[model samples]
Target: MDTSDVAETLDHLVADATDHHYSPYTRFDWVDELDEQQWWMTPDLLSVAGTRHARELDEKQLMRLSKWEAVNFFSLNIHGIRELLIEVTRRIHTPGFELPSEFFHRFLGEENGHMWFFAQFCLRYGDKIYPDKSLPVTTTEEDTDVAHFLVFARILVFEELVDHFNLRMGRDATLHPLIREVNQVHHDDEWRHIIMGRKLVGLLYEPLRERGDQDLRDRLDLYLRRYITASVQSLYNPSVYRDAGIAEPFAFREELLKDPARTAYHETFFKRITGFLSSQEIISGSPFEGSRV
Candidate 1:
């Protein structure tokens, strides 16, 4: 990667951003078509779907959990997109983002639209947004290279994490049509963001990689692995379990994490992102690698 390469990448991204222009206002049909008795997400996609716990659940209770799980998923999307909006917004015209300002504006607009739709789903269906239980962690490394890498990495990984669910639920016939549509729209929007994010991170990291600063590299990798783990853990909101009528929500979540089946399922969410990052040599080993989580 050279200086010209970075410019060429940014130029392409700007062109793509302009070509795929969209308006937040007309993106989704905002009418309330939710049925009270419908499964919000596919049953097989639930965290407890394959476990004995799901077996023990009656149809009514299972649907109850599905509704809450759907709400929880959308709520998490709201939070993640909000954070990304904040990250990109602050950098819109700042020193680090000037050259990419045009694309960043587009990125910010898309994120704002995503937040609106996601929050809209939670509000119309679940009646409120779920409180974010996922604690955000930041790297201690103070270098500009690490900070630049961290911001893009966070955005890219969050997209990867949630898009796994989006891609699955979007195509799943068992979920409500409205829910599936939402997922489909979100997955479609994130495809562009993911492309831009990956390129920026790869370009920004070239200097660090060239320097071969092992300690800084290790620090960044460790932060990413932890962030990956946290992203997976965010899905297991105890409040969601409680609202879904699961007893002792915290204890249940603890036990659920220990379930080999659930762990394996969670691992699937990271497979693509980890594979991409590793192939780029951005990371050596992923947090979701066997026995790592």
Candidate 2:
């Protein structure tokens, strides 16, 4: 695209993002405390193991599982936002992307504030936050711009996965109002982020595909598969299982991976991600195209 076109696109995106700004403190009725007994933690929003295996537990066990999953999901959000903020800050003032960069600067600030509030909830109730154990991998080994582009693409994919849940839970009036508001506000911002991510990935892909970089393309496909698998597996939090008195957490995770119910749940969560990857032709000739959802 020409400079003028890029400038105009960036301006529109910034305006859209700016118009969605919401007050985190007043958006929800935070004054209403949630009771463990009254809190009806929806199984669909819980992690795979927590939801699937929750039927075997009693009331206290269920509550523990629900709280743990909530903590885990929000903790992941905190870490993910932190990483994205760093990337946004690095590019915000850089040349060529000044227009988009200005909006992203606001995004970074908002996400930073989100991290603080999420951390506060975890610390205040759980007494601590879970540590991030997921290992970061380079999108490709190639020493080219495609590698960097793929990194951002993978980040976008992850954001989409989170946004899927956020969009659903955000407006769910059935859940606690505070939880719903948090999700609602987050989904509003993330909708713009996802759109920007899609555009950025498309722009990055066009040139790389034009150059016919087979190795880079192959690596991108592999990275996408790895990310999907890792994200699904992340739903099995050992701490949650341990806290709920489940025996041999790692062994349980391995077993759960083989369960039909668990596998189906993972497929559901990854349906959109896989579809998008395929539509982008990133996995056109790959085995995943024929794999079961």
Candidate 3:
């Protein structure tokens, strides 16, 4: 799609946003307190790795796991949103993207608001957020712009995967009312974000492929793989392990990584993402070939 098509798509997205916009401050009754005894994991979604493992723990262990997992998830969202906002803001005012600039401005405002509320939740209850960890870098001298594009593309891929879950969880009335509302609000905005990202990534990929830079393609695949791998690692909660009386949280992480169920789930998530890239022709079939680190 060309610039005009993108601008049109964005206009539709903006209209959709207007239809779905929600204010957490007003929509959710913050005065209705959540009981500590309630499980944060909705019954229908209890099969998630962390939730399944959490069931094996005692009350103290479950509480620690809940707090750590909540912080970890929120922290990742904060970091990811910040990075994407920077990228969008840098390009919004640049020449040649005038038509879609207005949509991007709205996107940045919505994401910034998301980052603020997520960070606020972490700080209010968790006391502190999780530390920032850099994703593995995969780049080469030739066609550096392709490398940068791939970084954001990989991020978009992850966001889409999470959005799939959020979309489902949001509509489930059986879930905790507050959790459902949060997911509903997030998914509403994310639908527009994912559409914009897919269009932008496709636009960026054509020139890179035209250059026929094998090294650039290789680096792109490496970045994609590293992003998916690290996303799985994000699910590991060292604090949970510590509370469960497991010594050497790192070793426990390693053990959990080896578990067949966990491994399969991780692969399932990445496979869905990689499948999208492959279908889009952004990455060839030989992804992550001859990459080490």
Candidate with best TM-score: 1
All candidates: TM-score: 0.91, 0.86, 0.81
Worst 10 residues of 2 by lDDT: 284-293
1 or 3: which has the higher TM-score? Answer: 1
Off by over 4 Å in 3: 1-4, 22-27, 31-33, 42-64, 134-144, 171-174, 243-247, 284-293
Local distance difference test, per candidate? 0.81, 0.68, 0.64
Task: Report the lDDT tens digits of candidate 3 across residue range 130-169.
Answer: 7766454445546556654765696687687667656766
Model 2 residue 131 lDDT score: 84
For residues 111-220, what per-residue lDDT tens digits would candidate 1 score against the true structure? 88888888888998889899887788866657876787788898899998888889999999887777888999888878878877877888778888889789878877
Query: Residue 172 error for model 3, in Å?
Result: 4.7
| Tens digit per residue, CA lDDT, model 2, 123-160 | 76566688888777644356545654665677687787
Ranking by TM-score: 1, 2, 3
- The candidate that wins on lDDT is 1
Q: What is the C-alpha local distance difference test score of candidate 3?
A: 0.64
